[model samples]
Target: MGRKVCQQDHGQSRQNSNGHSNDHLFSTHVQAVIVQLSRPVLRPGFRPDARLWRGGIEGNFEVTISMYDASVGLFVPYLRNLSALLDKGVAYAEARKFNPAVLLGMRMAPDMYDLAQQIGEACRHATVAAALLADREPVALPVLEHDMAGLQARIATSIEFIESLPRAEINAAAERNVFFRLKNGTELPFTGRTLLLTFSVPQFFFHVTTAYDLLRHAGVELVKKDYLGRR
Candidate 1:
């Protein structure tokens, strides 16, 4: 007798060689498995079906991570940590007998955005991505205020907006098409997943990290934990 493995087909089950029904296997989650056998059962152009599986003898399995988990799960914490990070900037300014607003003008390079702009971009990326995925208009950028409190308020507004989006709507947008328009009036097209993963998240983090670096370079004391927050 040949060794038999379980396969799922539209919720129906068949018995294996051991006379046990295989319906229970992979019934609970989305997964892809590549079994290691004498012969490769995964053929060329093999794709995950409705069940998200390709079967053969003993193989490897892949799990589907959700879009919601990838997007909001990341943006919220980092935005919160970003807010906390700015608070440290305020403290550093106070202790050194300088205006906290001074730090917002610091940047690593002359061509780059200063600390205030970086924070604004970070908040913009987070909120825009969430709004796009939720099928809503993104929050408009307010007039740039030169104060630390103003920047902090921007972060607060972003957090509130991102948290207000429905998780289900965002999750369902994984395959939806969205266009990103650049300042030059060029529109770039992307699916929701690609927009968030490839563009939005990366852009968001770049500005956030730049903001952190600006403060550190300006003599504000910050550790990695300040960036990561309580994990």
Candidate 2:
């Protein structure tokens, strides 16, 4: 995996009428995997399918790590990136094509098992990035495999870890480079402008949508509800 990049950049902060920073609503790292992962799979010929290029699968997997790193290192920067790509002016189809710089070497494949392995690797990266962003020394990626059961287990574990972080930790900082210490004692840095517009938005949805594409191509009997996962 590539070295984690910081997402923080300076920008104006949005605030609610009550004078509290609205950043928490957007900046705090939400465990969006299930919500993102649950999106209905798209097949070839779909509107945004062009985003799934030769390296689409691998690129998507790499973004998960990027998101984790962004969240821990610079929460606001990640949110800003996410907000820009997800903005109404940006067509969802066009947004789908966005890829972060950090995912340069990830590879895509045609087989289901290989696809599963890619997702597993992405999940592992997410785990490490999350810990590192929290300022702890990096830990080994959890054991994962390509089987459906293994994927489910890994996803469950990742979600639980994400949920455990303090909600305040998700809010945007006044300045960039606010660092968090992870359990292993490493510092992870963050920023606002970069957080919102750069790494966070593009990397996250890219993999999620690609994962859906892979499953759909393989003929998973997926529907909108399946994508939403009972939320």
Best by lDDT: 1
What is each predicted model's overall lDDT from 0 to 1?
0.77, 0.41
**On residues 1-231, what C-alpha lDDT tens digit does candidate 2 reach at each position?**
355643332144455333554444443333233345345567655443322432243344322223323454333222223222222212332345533211222235534334444455445444444443343443444565434444555555654565454434433232445444444898656553343345434544455445545444543344544433343
Give me the runs in candidate 1 sitting further than 4 Å from their true place. Answer: 1-62
Per-residue lDDT of 229 in model 2? 37
List the RMSD of every prediction in angstroms: 10.6, 22.5
State the displacement of the C-alpha of residue 144, model 2, in Å, after optimal TM-score superposition.
3.6
Tens digits of per-residue lDDT, candidate 1, 133-179, equal 99999877688887888888899888888877877688778899988
Candidate 2: minimum summed lDDT over ten consecutive residues — where?
81-90
Candidate 1 vs. true structure, TM-score: 0.73
| Cα RMSD of predicted structure 2 | 22.5
Off by over 4 Å in 2: 1-113, 121-140, 172-174, 178-193, 228-231
